[model samples]
Target chain A: MNNQFKKGVLDLCVLTILKKGDSYGYDVADTLSGKIQVSDGTVYPILRKLASDGLVSTYLKESQNGPPRKYYHLTDEGAKKLEADKQEWDVFTKAVREILEDEDK
Target chain B: MTKKEYLDKLTKELGSMSYNDVKDILSDIEDHFTVGISAGKTEEDIANDLGDPKALAADYKEGMDLPKILEKKTVNEKKPKAPEPTSATVCFCVLITVFVAIPAFFSLLAVVLTIVLSEIAVALGGIALLAFFWTFGPFKATGLLGGLALIALAVFGYALSYFAVKYFVLGTKWYIAFIRKTWHEGL
Candidate 1:
């Protein structure tokens, strides 16, 4: 996939993954990269950006493993951003699909 | 590449970024490696899956630069330069202080002094009456009562003078502060 295209939607994908539930940094990376063809490291910068933008907040929670994990939670601001970005994504993909179908004819 | 090798490269690639930002990014990547190892992945495989350190650092720098610039702008806007006092303001303050404030202050001081002096005179008169009665062969009861009454009145007068002097000094201080503020900030 083109790097530019992936870069644009990567934020949306991460937000969608977080909408499912609060998850740790590694889990978020795993979930996102499992489906998308991206480097596992991609999600960290996106998470940091989202957090700094006040869309998400993080806290350390004790895990059954060796140490506490940093979990990211969707703030009200994050949820609102997800809703808006989802709508925009839907319209954009639909328009692109239509353009491809027209070209097929 | 091992986790250490990957992190060192990323840190070098993130050149000129703030220390805290670099630390936070490194910690996040470190956590990823720790979890990957626990999940049955080798260090080499995990490092490979994380992609190039240089590219990752570039993404972070891209996202951060704009916000950092905006943050500085907001901080600058928060404290605008305070206006300096104009020559007219200085002239106005000086003229008012010399002509109006000084004369009023002196008149108030004179009034306070008069009250104090009168209180002292009343007290001295009371003492002199008591002494005159004491020296006489027969001390009159009416004279004794008058002396005690004069002394009580002087005591009350002295209390009133004390309050007057206190308020006069306080009012002058308050006026000076008000003028100084006005001189700097305008009326």
Candidate 2:
């Protein structure tokens, strides 16, 4: 995938993941990088940006082993944004797919 | 690259960012490394998967809106935000201005006006004496000398009044500025 393409949707992806449930930085990075061809380091900046934007709120929870983990929770604002952005993404991808299929025929 | 090497590069690449911002970024990365290591990944493996330190720093700089943050910091440094004066401070300033400063200023103003009026009267008196010098028939010499002396005294008085008025105006300006400063920043 193009770096710019991945960067553009990275925020949406991170927000969707947080929408599922609260997760820490490392967990979000692992989950995102598992599916996307991106560096594990990329998620931190996105998480930071989201937190700063008030889309996500973070709180530290004690882990079973090691220091407290900073878990990110999706705020109401973030959920609303995710709903709109997801709809836009679906519409955009469907159009692109139809165009590509037409070319193949 | 090892964790230490990765973090050092990231920190170096994040040059000129605020200390708190840099510290926060470094700590986050450090936490990532710690988690990765616990998850059975070697430092080198984790560092490679995280990609280039420079690129990661660039992403952080971009994502954090560095330009806006840096601009805000520089503006704050250039001109520290003035603290709002409390109600008590406003009351104190008002009281002082009304009871102390206003009265003092008016008194001084009256004194300056008196000096000015006295100087003007003296100058006019000197002129009148000079104009009526011919009327001193027998005491012509006395009248001439007295008129010259009065004119000299009036000239000196005018100079003195000029300085007093100038200083009085300057003092009023200074007092106004002081009051404004006190209004914005208590005491």
Candidate 3:
């Protein structure tokens, strides 16, 4: 897969994951890497970028076995962005699929 | 490498970034190693999966730079927006300038004058470099030296132009993104 393709959608993917539930850095990276062929470290920069962009906010939560872990939650601003991007992605993929399927007819 | 060693290398690679930025990035990497260890993954395995520290540092730097670039208002933004020009507003401003604002006129002139003079200086410097290449060299082969100088100048100019266009496009894209962000933030 093209790294450029991954880079374009990485922020959305991270946002979607956070939209599902608050998650720590490692778990987020792990979950994404499970489904996609990304480097395990790629998600951190995306998370930081999302945080800096006011799309997500971070807070420390105490874990049972270790020190407090940083967890990311989608901000209200992030929720709106996620909705917008999701709509855009849906429209984009629908158009692409139409173009691809038209060749068969 | 051990987790400590990996984090240390990453920390050093991130030198002179704000203490908080460096701390945040390092802590994230540290968390990866910690979680990997608990999940029965070796430090070496986790580090390998993460790839190069230098490459990761560059990504982090880019993320860190994004906010700085977006928040930076240029000199153009600082200049007051001129009011919509009606005939009455234009005549009143002209009268004010002619009668009451001689110093303001000269200050505006000073700004334009500096810009025009610097532009002339740059043009002259380029012309001078093109005209008198042989004077700098005590070499016997003045023709060969001048030819070499011209080639070097061409290459430098080409590289500069290429980079200038590249950066200009990147800046314009960033500006567009900043504008979109402002619209979204308004909501």
Candidate 4:
């Protein structure tokens, strides 16, 4: 699979996860790292990107032990884009899957 | 490797990004590990899941396009430039432009009028320049030129503010201080 395909999906996956509800930066990294391996410190840069572009808003919430944890909430803009990206991705992936299956035949 | 060793490796690899950016990203990774541990994953388990620090840092090194990553750091790099021209700069600029340029452009008056108002503005500006020096016009301790320029402005401003005040009024504080010292000595 194209690495671009994987990379594109990582952002969409992040937006998708946030679409359900807000989550802290670490939680998003951990959950996504389980399904697809990311680097030791990759998720943060993505979170910062999404945030600086106005796709997310971060707020500090009290943590169990240490300092207040920053939580990333998907903005309305992010949610709308996630819906659109979901449509585009599904169509794009389905077409690619069909092409691969035809090659198998 | 320990977390500090891992972060040091990341910092070494990502020399292009600011160190604070690298530090924030490292904190995010540490957060990932902490959350993973809470969820019943071992240190090794979490570490394995986080593929490679160098490769990940490369994903964020401005604009690195690989097979699967968007790597759009430059796309977000302009956020830090917002605080450069703060309010003090704006006010100081307005003060200088209004005070300096308008006075310097008085060429339309007849010979006598031109000499008089031009002399007045120039003379007053020159005196203000002196006071501007005495007051340490700008607060820049590190900027020699800026400090000097602002000191020039400070004199200009003082001349502009108190240009017409009589020498008697200006010396009142000195008189009071001298009287206090003499009277205290007499007592």
Q: Give me the candidate number with maximum DockQ.
A: 1
User: What DockQ number belongs to candidate 4?
Assistant: 0.23
Over the stretch B1-187, how does candidate 2's per-residue lDDT look in tens digits? 9899999999988777889988988989899988988999999999999989988888888887766645323324666778888998899889989999899999999999999999888888877887687585877777788788888988999998999999999999998999898899787
Alpha-carbon error at B17 in model 2, in Å?
1.3
The worst-scoring run of ten residues by lDDT in candidate 1 chain B lies at B67-76
RMSD of 4: 22.3
Model 2, docking class: medium
True-structure lDDT of candidate 4: 0.65
TM accuracy, model 1 = 0.58
Model 1 docking grade: medium
Q: Which of candidates 2 and 3 reaches a greater lDDT?
A: 2
User: Over 4 Å off in model 3, which ranges?
Assistant: A103-105, B66-187
Each model's fraction of native contacts: 0.71, 0.74, 0.66, 0.43
Give the per-prediction TM-score of chain B: 0.55, 0.56, 0.35, 0.31
> How well does candidate 4 score on lDDT at residue A42?
56
Worst 10 residues of 3 chain B by lDDT: B178-187
Off by over 4 Å in 1: B66-187
Write candidate 2's Cα lDDT for A1-105 as tens digits. Answer: 898788779999999999899999989999999999899999988999999999999999998889998889999999999999999999999999999999999
Q: Tens-digit lDDT track for model 3 on B27-118?
A: 88888888888889999999988878877877787777745554324346676654445665556555654775556546645655555555
Candidate 1 C-alpha lDDT tens digits along A7-64:
8998888888888899998899888889988998889889999999999999999988
- lDDT per residue for candidate 3 within A5-98, as digits (tens), equals 7877889999999999999998998899999998888899899999989999999999876678899999999999999999999999899899
